[model samples]
Target: MRDEWNAPWGSIPELVRWAAVRYADTEAVVDCGGRVRVTYAGLGARVERAAAACLAQGVRPGDRVGIWAPNSLDWITAALGAVSAGAVLVPLNTRFKGAEAADVLRRSGARLLFVTGTFLGTSYVASLRRAAGEGDAAGPLPGLPALRAAVVLSEDAPRSFLTWKDFLASGEGVAAEVVRSVRVPGTAASDIVFTSGTTGRPKGALITHAQSLRAYDTWAELAGLRRGDRYLIVNPFFHTFGYKAGVLACLTRGATMIPQPVFGAETALANVAAERVTVLPGPPTLFESLLDHPARRDHDLSSLRLVVTGAAVVPLSLVERLRADLGVETVLTAYGLSEASGFVTMCRRGDPPEVVAATSGRAIPGVEVRVVSPDGTGLPPGSPGEVLVRGFNVMRGYYEDPAATAEVLAPDGWLRTGDVGVLDAAGNLRITDRLKDMYIVGGFNAYPAEIERLLAAHPDVAEVAVVGVPDPRLGETGKAYVVRRPGSSLTADDLIAWSRREMANFKVPRWVEFVPDLPRNATGKVVKGDLREASGP
Candidate 1:
């Protein structure tokens, strides 16, 4: 495995091609809903065909291709193909609304977009078109000046869009030589992942292919992901957890990628038992749901060997329960962000439940992690301060936004994670608090700045401040303290309903409190500490 890791591979396509030859007959992907299975050899061919299709569409090297869809065979194929065609892949969060997706599409200047017509009872194409408007009357979708085409992954494509089948069929005209010629370098940008920014907008994080492959290679090794292992990926494909750790990791390890689009406990249990899945990685809530479900024992989960979970705090009892109740041998905890290719500190096997529960584990090989004071000096072990990371895993920069990139990323390569943590003598890191106000809801990052910006647009809202309060189910949910406009009769429920229409569900404040005015510091900044205290424990 070490020798294989040292081999020279330049890009995603090269990795796929090598995997095809090395693990030709090995199962690569299994679409649970479509009941489709593809081998390594077949998956490689599909990626190449998708690349040819992209070339036929006149997509040039370095072009941005946006994929706005949920996890599926088509999603993976489209993403891999675009990257193979030397185009930078831009993945849109499935949780995003039409306006949100359109904003990213416009900012990225994506020439082509692949969208799911419908998923989980919502029509994405229809919603985006509605947001973008119809025909010449709309005047080029407001901000999306470069968006020329969209391919809908459905039976019928929307107006001015191509169907999935037709999009692939367009490749028939492009010669294989054209696809082969568009070779992207390993150090070049592979994917531009947009994460919620502190400035109320999403910033694109440019990650290279070599960094991605290297980061996940160490990750797979630490997680005990082995050849022939059936990996049930419940994590969203948009995030690095699913795309890099789930899809790319499978290609490197010859594991079977069984993508579970939406996570439901009953469905997950049945799939684990039926498919004889050996590995399952998701947030702690997933395992909690599985354990709390009544029919958990009904499924034969004896094949389950590895479980990797992080993001939210993993209760000590949950870690113990996962082993005692389910017989999962190698349950590990990890920590990372989208900027780091989702590779950072990870707990090793055989660690005690207390250590696993309290700390995020030690840093992965080649990554440097430090707890630093406000002065940028490294703090002593056990002293809580900001967590700073510098390594091969850190992204090149936020795409096309050098000013915003300069704020968080240092010239010395240290990335200010905005997370506060303490390192033990053993080098295990225990996250104490966050320097930033960002919070996680069901493993998804919900930035207060982004949510507050949306809420501030409300006609009834005069002033607003958002904070993260503890929640048993989702780990943490947003609580908004709002000062309403004069004589406005807006109820908490009313504001919630209005927010639902304006923003993504995760970003919506679950709780609303009407206040005369927010408690402010001398600098005229809202004191979130006071609001958090007022909201109560």
Candidate 2:
């Protein structure tokens, strides 16, 4: 996986080892939720132990390893360990159901899985076991034929699954020098971030070590992240922004991480005041909630120095409020997607409030962004068209889906971002519409096709279509138009309840309308434009 462009300290293990020496005494990670703190030296030691555990469990280079957990010290150690063992990291959505998690694990042929015991009241282990317990695979989860082992990240585990303690203890026998000399994931696919495409199938975007490091190094630089800055990471670790911009960026700049598994304005304020958090980056809703929170004035939010927000259109008033109301030093907005290695454009620090609020700033270094017509011709500035990108930051391709890969990525190194945006005369990019009908719910990309696919499985749903509708809190949420089967009396409440149990929370449609039939165009395609109009502004 090594490449000429791969940095010596690019990979997780390499970064851990290097940071351990450079910032040994500096606070690295403080899990306020768990009441745990780990310095760089401690992170390095723990990661090394986890990597040894990975080897002891028979993980090999190029093997698919999955982590299904929330933001925590255990999640970081487990994911870094898998990569340190030369395994491709596959982070599962914490909001995912057992079925969805198993679907990815099975498709990726994950050899090992690290799962949390329980989170937000549901037992993740119980959910996964029930979902994957009936298959012919002789492993811990019988349904997953390729999964050889499951490590529970808690004190207790089923007899079949290995506890986190036992898993690490097995690696104690492995020589330290051997672990040090072990393979470092370089230019190879360090991770396969799974994203649902317009076709309703999950596609894994392959990003290499060099690409991630180079891009985020450029990101941390552009974002003006500095050493000793305490960052409160509210973004889920599964997304590229969280893993790369949140974790990787901190490592690059020696910033301390304060991971929050679930977001609550009250909790966030407490952390900012107590931990002296100086850096905060998240979706616009994060800032909005914090500003509107009843107890906001109770906490000493004066320590907040920076905020980077995007994934939805940022309001000019919101930007003004963050600066004026909160007295924040700097605020910026940016845009990205999974196919583009989770980054493409960002606002510069000194940009005016109008530019920062109006558009996702110019492309990061080494990347070319274009507004093109349907015929593939470039458009003039201010003319909206499909957004296209090309650069070292682009992903290798969608893992094992060359056809889908070919659909977006051209042979000459261009990636069709499937987003409609306008380029300002100054080269700033402002995204307008999602060409694939995808929407953002609290910074998570939700494809309508994916949600429709999930809904279509219901026995009562004879036909279904989903569209993004504006929401005050979450930015945007799904609204489903469904047709019931003959004589079926499935109510919206019933379907919504079923969806909560079946799909991730973000994908569950917040609004459901029982329609006679979906409006179709001349080509028999559901005209989403009419649906959005009917949904109202």
Candidate topping lDDT? 2
Instruction: List the lowest-lDDT window of 10 residues for candidate 1.
Output: 134-143
Question: TM-score per candidate, in order?
Answer: 0.97, 0.97
For residues 485-517, what per-residue lDDT tens digits would candidate 2 score against the true structure? 999999999999999999999999999999899
Give model 1 RMSD, 1 decimal. 1.9
Residue range 230-290, candidate 1, lDDT tens digits: 9998898899999999999898899998888888899999989988999999998889889
TM-score of 2: 0.97
lDDT per prediction? 0.87, 0.90
Worst 10 residues of 2 by lDDT: 1-10
Error of 1 at 372 (Å): 0.9
Native-to-model Cα distance after best TM-score fit, residue 216 in candidate 1, in Å: 0.5
Report RMSD (Å) for each prediction in the order shown.
1.9, 2.2
How displaced is residue 352 in candidate 2, in Å?
A: 0.2
- Point out where model 2 deviates above 4 Å: 1-8, 134-137
